[model samples]
Target: MVSTSTTGVLVLLGAPLGNPEDASPRLRTELARADVIAAEDTRRLRRLLSELEVVPGAVITSYFEANEAGKTTALLERLHDGKRVAIITDGGMPSVSDPGFRLVKAAVDAGIPITCAPGASAVTTALALSGMPCDRFCFEGFAPRKDGERRRLFTELAEEKRTMVFFESPRRVTDTLRAMAAVFGDDRPAALCRELTKTHEEVRRGGLAALAEGAEADPPRGEITLVVSGWTGPAASEATPEAMAAAVAALEATGTDRKIAMKTVALRFGVSRRDVYEAVLKAD
Candidate 1:
């Protein structure tokens, strides 16, 4: 049994994305020594513990999205009592688009010490396998489910210079790719990483349009992560008024609303919407 501190520490455990061997030694030790274990899925946690061959003596409780808000206070009470509380998710680190954010924030407000056992993350794994520039990147947890919202998001990120990573459902991957192709341009380079670190893991590299087509032909299964190359177009400052107007006109020709087309062009070119509007007027 590990010694406990006077003030309990919140240990954020990183569950392996898929492979059990990827679990860190420190994570194993923490699992065995925790006073209480809060898991996103108790069944999954059981499978993991069985795989790791570690018998945890801690009191295990389910801490998932639905009950996270209600359970945080009770967990905080345990922490105040100096019990080592470990938070584990289905995969990857807790609180990264997961259920632990609320508890983490509550613990922070309560002045509890927090630490983590870092392990395999799909974000970095897919990013590494993507063959895109990794020096700079952003993780957009999951694309919006709604068509309009998702398109708007892609439009806003159209000019992002950093490589982008996104988690997407298998069913929506193809559609999401098509939406991305529409806003980020058909020729933009991208990679689709599916079932990462698992037996049937696969990575498909191509332009957004090609990816969409391939996915439509043969739907991918398991968890999906997308890595898209950032915009490499001329800087917004270098964009001439004529160029902005032409871009908006192109979108408008595709049946996009005039105002919305102007906004999309502005975002794609990294210019003010007003500038795109003025350019359109001058072109007319």
Candidate 2:
């Protein structure tokens, strides 16, 4: 379907996250004109085209994580044969916790020109809707499936000052929330974005501990994006003994035991629990 002789080019296409109208005219044209189209799921591509009412004119083939390595070579051969190839995923951009990295790298190494037709991304979409600071943020793809690894990862990022974005499955969403509350503190502000850009889209914003409890009470369904507020870092003046004692006192007032409150305060501030304990005792 490609009319031009221009070849040896790889195009990365960004599929709509949910809404069919989000598909761009450029994407439609490319889908109809590319020499060959590599898709994460050919059936999903067909469905998307059906919804968009734009049947692809090019040959469509699967290029998912399982077989990307093998297909990249074949795809590069097509490119070398003066064919235009476009790569698309079921949702959002490719290689962001998805397939296509291998092909992109191979294309680049082979001097095959690479370009992109950017579109909706759940990462940015959720970040925008999360009501959290977006100026500085990090997308942590997906959390570890193992509890220990996930918690260790959370512990490592506990002091990260940049707002964090994470993808989670509905099944483990509650567990992830609980782990987040444990590592980042129960009072940390967070948002659970579910089924983003879809009819059943929902965004629940609250303290991590409360969200954990709510997820426990009623498990969520659909794709999930968890956005948590970042540590703002210690104030320039640093927390004095008085400030540390006051923080523990505030937690105690909220029914947290005095000893537990002191430890919580220390973890939240990246300070010593012993120091917090001493501060609390002196205040008493």
Clashing pairs in 1: none
lDDT of 1 by residue, 78-197 (tens): 999999999999999899988999999998998899999998899999999999999999999999998778877887898899999999998999989988876776668999999888
The lDDT, on a scale of 0 to 1, for candidate 1 is 0.89
Q: Which sections of candidate 2 miss by over 4 Å?
A: 1-7, 234-267, 273-284
For each candidate, the alpha-carbon lDDT, in order, equals: 0.89, 0.85
Q: Which stretch of 10 consecutive residues in model 1 shows the poorest summed lDDT?
A: 247-256
Candidate 2: give its CA RMSD in angstroms.
5.7
lDDT of 2 by residue, 162-223 (tens): 99999999999888887787666667899999888889999999999899899989888988
Model 1: CA > 4 A from native:
1-5, 234-256, 266-284
Q: By TM-score, who's the top model here?
A: 1
